[model samples]
Target: MHRLANPTRFLRLCNMVKPWAMAITLLCLATGLYFSLFKSPPDYQQSDTVRIMYVHVPAAWMAMFCYSAMALSSAAALIWGHLVAQLIAKATAPIGASFTFLALITGSLWGKPMWGTWWVWDARLTSVLILFFLYLGFIVLHDAFDDTSRGARAASILAVVGAVNVPIIKFSVDWWNTLHQPASVVKLDGPAIHSSMLVPLLLMACGYTGFYLWMLIVRMRAEFNSNKIRAIRIRQANR
Candidate 1:
């Protein structure tokens, strides 16, 4: 990680990895979509509506995971003064926000058919909404100050503080009486969902994770290039 901290080294590594990551992301998305749309069996209870889970659940997972990633990167930035860590946190915010939005929209879509309502103030839903706001807040806070480092530091603090919401989002169903269903794919005992459903769900989850990585790498690379161009302009101005 330290070795890759240098911008040049990071760029080199990204160049090497980008093709493979993009390829895998494409493959996973294609396979996952096929499995999700064609192969997966309908839930006994919810029928065709349950199919939305493949997209909704995975987007929800990525939304939380991306924020967690941002929080960890923010922590590293605060402790180690690593610019790459700060850049990663910055790059991840919009992607995570998009995923959160997808989760909410898809969840609402799924809900209307199953729950007869498009929205609810359930604990899990509310907490995830809060998480989405946190992402927006981080992006806003990071750009609020003229001094980039100061803005990054402030955003980092907010990211760390917002970490509290992640677990709440995960356990809200268990911790409170909520309209959201309890854990199905991940549990202490085992996945309660049948294998027919689980396989497509897992594929979708993998696809979403790959998509996140692909976007993150692209965003980070663009950020690095922008910084380089800024540095060159500053040097030219000085001369």
Candidate 2:
């Protein structure tokens, strides 16, 4: 991590990885969609509505994944004073929020047909809603101060603290009576889901992961450039 602290080296690395990330994202999403929409068998109960799982499940997973990334990055920034880590946490906010929003929207759509309702206050649903708000809060807190460093510090602390929600969201269904189903793919034994559905679901997850990585690099690059420009302006004003 420290080795890549140099802005030039970091940017060079981003340039190298960006194209591969994009390629993986495109390939995986295309293949995943094909398998999910065309090849995968429909659920006996949910039927066509089950197709929405491909999108909703992956989006939900990515939402938590992104928040975890942000929390780790924020911790590094606060503990080690790594500017790049700070920028990374900052860059991740909107993307994480976007993923959370996607999850919520898709989940609602899926729920309407399956549960006969558009919303629920079940443990999983409520906790995920809280997670979404946490993302928004992080973004708002980060820009709330005139002193950028102070704002960053405040936001980083919030991120680290809010990370407690991730696990709560994960375990909510297990811990409480809920409309949400228990874990199917990720389990102590093995995936309860059939290979037909599991394969495309896994593919979609990989695609979402690649998309997040690609977007992270792009956003980090933009954030880095913006910081540089801000520094230059400050220097000019001082001069």
Q: Tell me the alpha-carbon RMSD of every candidate.
A: 1.3, 0.9
TM-score of each: 0.96, 0.98
Off by over 4 Å in 2: none
Per-residue lDDT of candidate 2, residues 43-92 (tens digit):
99999888899999999999999999999999999999899998888988
Which 10-residue window of candidate 2 scores lowest in summed lDDT?
Answer: 1-10
- Candidate 1 lDDT tens digits, 1-239: 78877878887887787788788778887988898889888878999898899999999999999999999999999999988888999999999999999999999999999889999999999999999999999999999998878999999999999999999999999999999999988899999988888888888888788788888889998988877897898899999
Candidate 2 similarity to native, TM-score: 0.98
Best by lDDT: 2
Using TM-score, give the best candidate's number.
2
For all candidates, the clash counts are: 0, 0
Angstrom error of the Cα, residue 14, model 1: value is 1.7
